[model samples]
Target chain A: NAGVTQTPKFRVLKTGQSMTLLCAQDMNHEYMYWYRQDPGMGLRLIHYSVGEGTTAKGEVPDGYNVSRLKKQNFLLGLESAAPSQTSVYFCASSYLTPSGGRQVEQFFGPGTRLTVL
Target chain B: GIQVEQSPPDLILQEGANSTLRCNFSDSVNNLQWFHQNPWGQLINLFYIPSGTKQNGRLSATTVATERYSLLYISSSQTTDSGVYFCAVGDYNQGGKLIFGQGTELSVKP
Candidate 1:
């Protein structure tokens, strides 16, 4: 099963250009997240969705937007990209077991590398 | 807000040696995980130890929830074990969002 798959494995964009990265999960998870990783830094959350049609801002959500139009798809949009926005992006999906404890073991995508010049 | 921190920003080990990586977090958390990002850049989940101890093969993890720290023990290290290890945490208030530590870059030499 393709747990999680991200579109456009690699891309290069000039400053101010816009693009969208697509993430799809076949695990039927109820939650999806978007994170960016810079050199020597941890992955920081940009946005996430608890379920279809619901989205929330994350630790680093200033320059990005997200939409979850379908349960299986989450999209990250860079309206006006900047050099600082160039980073490796990851998408993950998981579920909080109904039983208890709220344990989460996320499944991650391969990642999308974007270079802005 | 919660914050996660990992120690020994980098580590180098000879084949067959053993090592331990630590992760400390501020504030309480409902979920905690250890992930290994291979040289190929794929993030692989290693452990989901929010609390207690779990062992698998040459790897074992222990989480002392009360102390807000976790430890990942790698025994008999091999060259193939070289990678960046990350610790991520999640709280109930964040709607399933996770905070990740800077990571510990490990290099195993033969």
Candidate 2:
């Protein structure tokens, strides 16, 4: 099974342009996250979803928006791309058990490289 | 927000040598994981050691929850191991919202 997959492996956009990154997981995980990796910096959470139809902002969510309308899909939208937004994006998913037990391991997607010019 | 820190921000090792990476957190956590970002920018899960020790082939990890620190050990390093290693922590009540360390950049030579 494809654990986690992200669309648009690479993209380049002019300033003020808009784009959406899609993430899908086949693991039936209840949690999904969007993160961006910058040079010499750790991956920072952009947005996350605890379950279907629920979304929350994370560490860096200023210029981004997220939607988790379906259990298996999470979408990240950049309404106005900026040069500062150029970075590799990663999507991850994890399962949460009924008794409050949660999966510690987060399976990550291959990543999408976005370049804002 | 919990703070995560990693030591030896940069490391260089010869093939066959061994090395250790350390991660310290500021608060209690229910889950801790290590990830390796290859040169191609793919993050591969390495370990999920909230406490105790777990070994997987040449890689092993140990976490001491009481001290809020975790360690990753790589035995017989390979050139393929050259990349950035990150330590992420999931807080006690945060539902999988992981906070990450800056990461230790490792370079293994042939």
Candidate 1 lDDT by residue in tens digits, A14-115: 999999999999988888999999998889999999889999998899989999999999999999999999999999998868874363788899999999
Stretches of candidate 1 above 4 Å error?
A99-103
Location of the lowest summed lDDT over 10 successive residues in candidate 1 chain B: B89-98
TM-score of 1: 0.97
The residue pairs in collision within model 1 are none
Evaluate model 1: give its lDDT. Answer: 0.93
State the lDDT of candidate 1 residue by residue for B1-110, as single tens digits.
Answer: 78788998999999999999999999888789999999999999999888999998999999999999999999999999999999998875567788999999999999
